[model samples]
Target: MSKVQKPEKSDKIDNIVGMLMEYEKMTVDLMRKATDTPILEQYDLNAPYAKARIIKEDGQIKYRIDEVTLTDEEKKKLKEIGELLIEELDVDIKRLGSNENAAAYIRKLVERIIKNYKIKLTTDSLDRLMYYVIRDFVHFDKIDPLMRDPWIEDISCNGFGIPIYIWHRKHESIPTNVIFQTAEELDKFTLKLAYMTGRAISIAQPVLDATLPDGSRVQMTYEKEVTRRGSTFTIRKFRERPLTCTDLIIYNTLSAEIAAWYWYVIEKQASVLVVGGTASGKTTTINTLAMFIKPNAKIVSIEDTSEIQLPHENWLSSVVRTGFGVSGSISEITLFDLLKNAMRQRPEYIIVGEVRGSEAYTLMQAIATGHGGLATLHADSAEAAIHRLESEPMNIPRPLIPTIDAIGVQTRVQVGEKSVRRMVNVAEVVGLDPTTKDVLTNDVFKWNPKNDTYVFYGRSYVLENIMKRHGYKHEEVMEELNNRRMVLEWMVRNNIRDFKDVVEVIRTYYVNPQQLLERVKREKMEAPSGGSRPA
Candidate 1:
């Protein structure tokens, strides 16, 4: 008998490919069945896969999937489809004008490719392929879903071959399923992102900072030469409608009473500084409190990136421009320069997004001249905020720190397994303490972590100042505050939390306080006596 011939190398490879295809089919079927479960529908797949088991490892609660992956064959097919579509379309996705247009075009193009190729794929597999294709071409690549998730505070990629991490609104920081597996891929992706920001990256300039098309702030490191890792990028997603005072109340970030007090204080033209560290809700708090300013006032807001959204027609928003050289000047304009120019514009309320560097001095001087400034600062507490102003970079005189009439501390703290943002403290800058050479502040609101609530510690000196300035009696002030509180509660109860609706209510309060209050109270009383509202 003739010896049996050994299987050819190509035959073995073909056998392996056939096995992978079978595996891919099984995987697709299982995924479809898994997704069809009722529980999975309620839990958004993009939101950290909430239904999965969460393990406590490395000081974080990480959601883990034991077994779920794409086979090499599936990945190869996806790559082939993507390339074919790009070749056939020959159109720049960025120039597609709107996401809706791009999405429509992509859907039709993908369907055509599927029909022509006659590929054997399940409905679920086709859907998955379409998502990846749209992500890579029409959106932010692998992190597109995370970018669209409103609850995601941040999207951070450490480096090539590393898993991406995200800061979820509920979960603090969790690892994601997305990754950039190669240096060339990440380098090219960052360059594309930089282009979206109207900037460029290269060996000469390995660092890039930009604001994306959707207003999110992006910072990226080009290559391994600049970053120890291959490449990295972080995106701080922007909120279309920055949280309003009523939203803070609804979220329990602050109490209705505290919001009312701030409303009165802002109405009286008192300056305020919201203090907190990184990822704290300082900007959110200030942007919300800004709604308290009179709608007709001439408000000038200055910042490096445009984050504040105001409904006032008289508002002038200004953003600082970076210079041509790294930290150098070509046609550069700084926050300090904007503040100086704002002074000339005779703005009734001056809003500085953050007080970093010497701009603090000009802001304080503006506040001293009764400009009614509102700003945010990075600090742990009220005292630290004052110290930051008086210290090196800021160098505002000790006496001028008091010009900031109120300090609101926004703290992002871990409450059990969930991360929650709360206004931990609100203090009125009474005056300077002669004995201790410190900024004297009267603590008005303090957070009780045990109860997970904010409690009033003392009467607000800012409120008293407002009362005296407006020539309103103590009872009158208290009555006005109670009326405002009632309206706020009604809004929260009825879920009138949109920024525009909140602004409309506030504006109505200014034009016709009694009318608006009566309408709100009527709506509240007509509703059932008891209804569940978010805490």
Candidate 2:
């Protein structure tokens, strides 16, 4: 039989190619016809891999994510091939660097497997198969589309069997069509999340608080250990491009006047504490206001989980590190530790993402030492914020309270049928009363609920101090405020809402105010009447 010589290498390669070609032909022949699901709105989250649709079902609006659907035969093949691939494929995913690179690597391996096994699949089917594989291995699997949706601010899964709810930018909290059908499924997903964050989650240590690779804040509990239900998770998505001061003005979160006032105070290196309830946009306001800090000033930011984003080149960002092995271990780094280190760094500005525990005292000390402080507090009003600071945990002395220049009270309130965030009060910390020993604050701006407008009290102690320090007369300061207001309005009108663009404009004004102001005036004059204002 001539020893039944094994197929030559070239012949073997040709055989694989021929087999793939034949499989492609078979798949083309077996292709099945593939939604008029009442889509109110639809958009691609990740083109070709996933899409999101706002649909109405049984009189309820729901967010539905549509991904590639496979036939039963294809699904079975995918499972078999995936198991084999996982067992045999040797890849150092970390060495791949990015999701795109890892995806390409996975695709190559899947293709090699298909060729070796002579798996029957068309090009389109292979593409679909690769998407699921990459999604499960490199992304968040079923919720990957939700993770890609830019309009979603928060995603929460209370437990297995419960529909995932997303906090949509336009629709508020709405249920999505995705759910974890079994406790084991959610446990696996929770474990995957922990692994992604380079942490561990188990029945012994169930709680997990971590920042995702994309900077989104995530808190999870594993396998019904601490939570009453199954594994639970809440993700607060981070914006790639942070909101600018102009964005707040456009959202009516604060008036342009308030923004200009903040610009003036921030330029003067005044300490500000933004206080609000949950999801009231406190951190957002501080992050926006931080852009007004002089471009060259040395700044340090400390956070439990990184949320503050700035455009300053001379900025240092730090986040608390959870300890390994046990709580309060030496390896752990707390906000208090970071704040102390920030003081040693001699930063001109110290930004605390949120002042919750003992770190509040360190921040107060930094502010007292004349480091410009920016922070957020979970409180309803200026008084409440002061009380919290002076109480236990924070325990900031009354004398240190006045070291904070202003308290911006932000709140989310109902406007018509929708909830809107507004800076309800901008109070200047005048000082502690000699007799009463109470922290006195002058309300510079107060939001009027009736007309949905902000009323400036016509006088700001903070602005007055700024004027004195800068040697500006009252009239000159007022004129300067108007100029800044006009500049901000011009930016809003010109749609210069990008964080970096806003920073450039502010920096340009600092370098050459006349040049920028003249440009703004010229643009305003050249525009058609009423066209220079934002709609």
Candidate 3:
């Protein structure tokens, strides 16, 4: 990859590090406007220095400009002249001090002065010209394939000795050639990120974890204490536009029919758990499912790395801090601690990004409190998911498992040309075996690898049990399922999905079925699209 070379710091103190990048741009523009600043008449890329000539007040001299040194007087003159030149051409005065504040760097400049026997510009003036040449250089221009990368979910560095690795959407994890020039530079960057988050990362606190200004989660271990390298940092990039449920439908990640039934459950305030292997789209699934929640419902989401994004305004997002053992401050609340506090907040719904440790017990206790909760977990199969919940670390008792509304096991299978990933099993916990502890999950839909399709064992038995709990007749339950499935299919067909309409239908249907169904019929009469109105 060709790196787009740029100055590390701009002269515009608004640039970064109290420097001024804009001043450079203004100078170039002035030079360009004054005499149409001529490009070097002779140029060579391979060599750092090539024959380039410029007219100074003294005269002209052939020399490579970038490496030239100037006396104090000439430096002051460069600053004076550059300022006057840039002011002639207007530039955005506001953005001149954005990142590191480049304005502080305007101390001096190089100027052409009278020389022996004649007026001519030498290497000193040429240095000034070269500095003005490329002031618009945005920091990190050269290795931007790694910086501005769209799919890079994570950027990590173990220290100055190793290359950076990025987690891309399609490429998964790939190493980049970007390297810090020194260990001190790497440490400064880590401290900067911690500083941005109002946290500290230093040798006194060898380990540092905090969120960057751009919302990327960062963690760094300093010197040989934590790792063999001097210092290493990892940045988990947050998605700019997270994939919504509609995107899932279009991507074939899940079927519209299943999504429709789930919408009904969500509006009913069903507690759900999403299970998947690493990189199996677990977090995305949690984020997409959050859309089904009632718009006004109060939601509190806790995470070690902030990942879940809800469209609702009534939501609180929190992340855990770790102990400063590795080198930094060890002042972070445990997930268990956050969960206890969340209970007091009385959130209508509680979301844990990924559950581990004692928090599982309190989170389960919250579920028993009648608050709707949504979370994701790492497990291969539905049974495995249950075991992980009931086993040692999580230790969620088997009896309490009934409080969970559904266990969604997302899986991937190879289908000829490419690997196809899907929400293979959406199992409902009707009732567990009293004696044997084994969960009796009715896998509603299973992928048939041979045909490269799914076997939708239509009309979930799970729906029947839940409907009975609500005092609905068998016929009423079946009719409601078909009704929702229709809206879902229509959403898939007409691309009229946003989940808000679907959730409204579910809520209305659950609280009062007759009024909403009747409205759907009456609205269908004058419907312009010829499809059912989920409203």
- The better-scoring model by lDDT among 2 and 3 is 2
Candidate 1 residue-wise lDDT at 140: 81
What's the true lDDT of residue 99 in model 3?
A: 32
Give the higher-TM-score candidate: 2 or 3: 2
Q: Could you give candidate 3's per-residue lDDT for residues 45-150 as a string of tens digits?
A: 2134222222222232112222334567666655655555455433432355543443223212112222221434566465454443223221222233344455
- The TM-score-based order of candidates, best leading, equals 2, 1, 3
User: Which prediction has the highest TM-score against the true structure?
Assistant: 2
Alpha-carbon runs more than 4 Å astray in model 3: 1-145, 158-162, 181-185, 321-331, 411-420, 458-461, 478-535
lDDT winner: 2
- Candidate 1 lDDT at 393 equals 86
Check candidate 2 and list the clashing pairs: none
Cand. 1 Cα-lDDT: 0.83
Over 348-464, each residue of candidate 2 has an lDDT whose tens digit, in order, gives 999999898999888887888778989999999999999999898889888988899999999989988788899999999999889998889999999999988999997899878
What range of 10 consecutive residues in model 2 has the weakest lDDT sum? 29-38
> Over 4 Å off in model 1, which ranges?
1-93, 103-131, 434-436
Q: Write the per-residue lDDT of candidate 1 for residues 1-535, one digit (tens) a residue.
A: 9999999999999999999999999999989875544331123434332223335544555544322345677788898898889778967766888877998899899889878988677776776677677767778876776776666789898899988888877666888657888989899999989988877787777887779989999999888867898778999999987787777887789999999988988888889899998988888788889989998999999998878888999999999987777655888899999998999999999999989899899998888898888999999999898888888988989888788899989988877867789889998899987899777889999989998888888578887777777787999988988999998898888788888888999999999998998898788779887797755
Return the clash pairs for model 1, or none.
none
Please provide TM-scores, in order, for all candidate models, with all chains considered together.
Answer: 0.83, 0.91, 0.65
